[model samples]
Target: MVRLGNLVNAEGRAARAAIVDYGYRTGLLSGLAPEPRERQGAWLTPRRLAILKLIAQGQPDRKIATAVGCAPKAVTTAVHHILRNLRAEDRAHAVALDHQQGLLTQPLVPLPEHRPRRVFSALEAQLVEALAAGQTKLQIRTSQGLSAKTVSRLLTGAAAAAGVRPRRGYAALVDSAYRGRLLTARAVDRASAPCLPERQHQVLIGIAHGWSDEQIAHRLGLSTATVKTAARLLYGTLDVATRAQAVARGWDLRLLGAPRPATRATARPGAPSRAAA
Candidate 1:
């Protein structure tokens, strides 16, 4: 039997195919190869088919609009139109039909070779060291003249490469560490700064929220590549080693807010109810 780890390794060896294969297998992505749409006697327009492909990539309405250079509302209408025409239940079903028809290509899932481990880049290693010494996103961006978005991306990508995927509650830690680093980096020079668009800001925030580049781009009306670029800028600015750290920093700085403290504490007085902080 092929081990799952082995499959990931094999998949990782090939960039294009690996993303789909590993992403879907790891549950990071969905709808890689959906069932065929089974629509007959009616042909789909090239535009409709194109929209289906985008949907398969996890693009939302806004993303579809940007990709097609149309309004977000228009994209929504187009999607409904396509769904009606295909007579499919939803977008996934439409994609499945397109894939089976060979109108869209399906990427196969890759098997892992051995134990999955973290990967790091030279810059990421340096950033990790800087973070260990306490660096800040703004400071790094000022000194390096990189955008916050890029820095955030680098950190997250590094974390993923390091095989340390963040699950739940990792956000708090990442946010704290990120803010600490930002403060450290800031002491150097305050004047120089990178220009980060508002859209990019939202994208980075989404990344910190654990959204994928595709999802972020889709939600924010940007391209996946643009989303990725923002992430890269974020990491560069923070001088952090991974995305997790950037997110952690964002949280610490209230760039990403934590859950509001419990409005009411219902412990009995002096009964050793709750441990002292």
Candidate 2:
């Protein structure tokens, strides 16, 4: 069979090396195990650079040493330092990262002509926005009341929809989302302080303090009906759907820094004793 013949003739590790060499360059594959994120604080020498270039070309230790005019043992030692300094997993990983980071401009292997584009479903798009909004998987789970397994599935599904490996493709997913217009550059800008009306501000502060609507009504010297109205207005102003969301959004928008503790020693008339919401 043609398939059998192709498998038999496969170049094995050389093919894999070529994939890593230009897969990211062509925008197809980002290796599942990413380069380690430790700072690249160590300096690289010219000899080490030559070794890395040869390694990227899928050369063996002997070839790398001969190309760099060094002993094969020295090539092995330089490799150890390259992995440490770049926080790379191995030679191929270093090659991928080198291309990704623009350390080595020209890949020895020819770049692929085209790469598969990343795509996202509608649900995945929404998840990307939530992630960009600073919600973590755990926070999303609790807020959305999703089971742990369901949360995992949804995140994994989102990654798949974006054509990335689940969990391991966090950076890739985010990058694709930005490229796809699911998240905006404006959202990356720092937000200005939120300005709410006086009544809404009081209600929001009370909510942040974990006070019930009844407690907020009594403390702010407003009727329960008025307190409810203010809370509704506060929610609208923050564009949040729930109290917890409002609190989080408040913190995000710089509206709620630290709680200004209750200053009045004297309780207002009809103020109920403090209790959590």
Candidate 3:
């Protein structure tokens, strides 16, 4: 009898696991297994919450450290913890999630007035603004009298100044700077302009939501190579280099509207369903 009871318990456990796996893959389960028992903000301590607020304002690690009265390394560690806890892909995602979860209601302590550093040349600024505005490289080159090589170099510099890795490209730099409230009104205006057609915009949204290229291609009913080509072209037009950065830029620019509803599918145990894309 004891052995039979144990076998029954094992079967029950397996059944529960299967159900959860199904829910997760189908988008019925919104977060990871073992979801937080408490509210989302319950896990964050007061200091971590303060750091999150600073992060939302686009403060870099050093600045966050200064404002939080902690070492820069400590701030970095906390940020990583925050990301893991939030299950966010990156800083931009963390900020967005925080806002969605209503964790940004805490009053922010203003940092002291500091002189803003001039980081970009006038020409470089114009180029970045144009890039954010969805202008093609050729259009910018023709209007600004810049060679392709020069434009690339300037973009690299701009990316560095905005505290973004240069390889992430100019769109990421612009998005980061804009999030930090560093760009001018004209730059924001240009960046806010719509640049993608409907299908491409859907593709960008899928990418932003952490969908793999193959998964996106499958859901969109396009060939994998076509999806790859479209993604590449989308990246170039947005002036971003990495998929993660492209998502960040898309979110910052409001190019990705509300997330799509999750769909039911016969996806693999852990694979996301088409609607989740």
Candidate 3 local lDDT, 7-33, one digit each (tens)? 333222223323333333356645533
Whole-model Cα lDDT per candidate? 0.49, 0.55, 0.55
Alpha-carbon RMSD to native, per candidate: 18.5, 24.8, 20.5
Per-residue CA lDDT of candidate 1, range 1-277, in tens?
1354354443221223333434544566555555545554434543455565666555666666665445778667877887777676766555545545655652111111111123234555454444434455666667667688876776665455333454332332233233323212222232444433334446556655556778667655567986777677776766555665665444434444333332232322332222111
Indicate whether candidate 2 or candidate 3 has the larger TM-score: 3
Clash-forming residue pairs, model 3: 263-275
Where does model 3 exceed 4 Å of error? Answer: 1-118, 184-277
What TM value does model 3 have? 0.33
- Candidate 3 versus truth, CA RMSD in Å, comes to 20.5
Worst 10 residues of 1 by lDDT: 107-116
lDDT (Cα, 0-100) at 186 in candidate 2? 38
Error of 1 at 159 (Å): 15
Best by TM-score: 3
TM-scores for all predictions: 0.30, 0.31, 0.33
**Candidate 1 local lDDT, residue 38:** 56
